[model samples]
Target: MPSPMVSIINVSKRFGALQALDEVSLEIPRGAVQCIIGPSGSGKSTLLRCINQLEPTDSGAIFLEDELLGFERKGDKLLELSEGQIAGQRMKTGTVFQRFNLFQHMTARENIVEGPLRVLNRPRGEVMDEAVALLERVGLADKSGAYPAELSGGQQQRVAIARALAMRPKLLLFDEPTSALDPELVGEVLAVMHDLASTGMTMIVVTHELAFARDAASNVVFMDRGRIVEQGLPTTILTEPTEQRTRDFIGAER
Candidate 1:
């Protein structure tokens, strides 16, 4: 079998007195969508952050496409890479947060173009073309010239998705992609995500949207108190979870 697209091994993270992640290990194969669901402070978001080294793992390691991320392995020793090297490895994973963290001063088109031009150092003309195409893909072609102030919460989030996509990341991490949107606006953003998933993008989503998780996820993981309670195919996990915590959590959500 081909290697998993993302391999996280015995990962643990702590913040002073509180442990955020506890001996977590997971493997996401290429083109798979894994949805992580649980209550607040379950460390779902922290796990996503660790994947890209946004929050460093206190122990263990994360890899992308067989490459050791954020560190180099010499025999049994793992040495942290330089900031420059870490930044390069991080580019392989794109992240979309609960908040649409856009630059208020830049237009949607400019926001989408900024990364490829500044980080990737692609030619301006090529980046502009790709940015425009991405805007169209996200159903925001008309809003390309619009500033963040002029867009709805859903629209801005869609633009954020487009911006992340412009980087052509190997893996996408979404942390509650719809949590901040108004109820009426959530579907639009979810629709874009559904379409993206259909196209076989490798994604790891942290969300509470059970319907989306059931409909679009290849696998579902139930996490609580910084540990995975259970995980399996979405149908099995959602319909017939064996763990009492998983069943109770799903029941409470319902």
Candidate 2:
């Protein structure tokens, strides 16, 4: 059997007195879209952070394509990787934040090409061509020369999505990606995401957009108090969840 794209085994994280994640375990298959939904402070975003190694787990382990993340096993000991190594691993997963975090001074094209050019050291012409294609993929080909400040909220967020794609990441992590946009603008960003989903990109989205969850996600996970309350097919979990916590949360979302 092919290995799962991402595996979280008994992972836990703490922030002082607050437990951000508690023995969370999940397996995400390749080319699957998993939507994580819950109330605020439920550790949905924290889980994404841990998966990307932006935040460390206090216990347990996370693996991408069967390779341990953030550490290497040597004999009986597990050694943490160097910063450079960690950065390399992180490049495999791309994250889009709630707020569009594009570089203010850079044009959309520049933002998309920066990582491929500077970090991966790819050929300049190749990266530029890919950047143009990525911008077109996100429905912003004409906006490539525009700076973030000159674009609408949805356009900037689309640029952010293109930037993430430019790296050709194995997985995409979206944390409340449309939360900062106006209601009218939200559909544009979600539309782009829907297209990505159709292409079988592995994505884990932390979002309150239940419609997207219902339509785009292969599975839906509901979390509360740093623990997974329930997880199953989106049709089941979103419509007929067995757990009271899951039902309550889904009820509140609508």
Steric overlap count per candidate: 0, 0
Per lDDT, the best of the predicted structures is 2
| Runs in model 1 lying further than 4 Å from the true structure | none
lDDT of 1 by residue, 87-158 (tens): 998888888989989889999999999889999999999999998899999999899999999999999999
Worst 10 residues of 1 by lDDT: 88-97
> Which clashing pairs does model 1 show?
none
* Per-model TM against the reference: 0.98, 0.98
Expressed as tens digits, the lDDT of each residue in 1-254 for candidate 2 is 99999999999999999999999999999999999999999999999999998897888889999799988899987788898999999999999999989999999999999999999999999999999899889888899899999999999999999999989999999999999989999999999999999999999999999999999999999999999999999999988999998888889878
RMSD of each: 0.9, 0.9
Evaluate model 2: give its TM-score.
0.98
Candidate 2: worst 10 consecutive residues by lDDT?
71-80
Cα lDDT for residue 17, candidate 1: 85
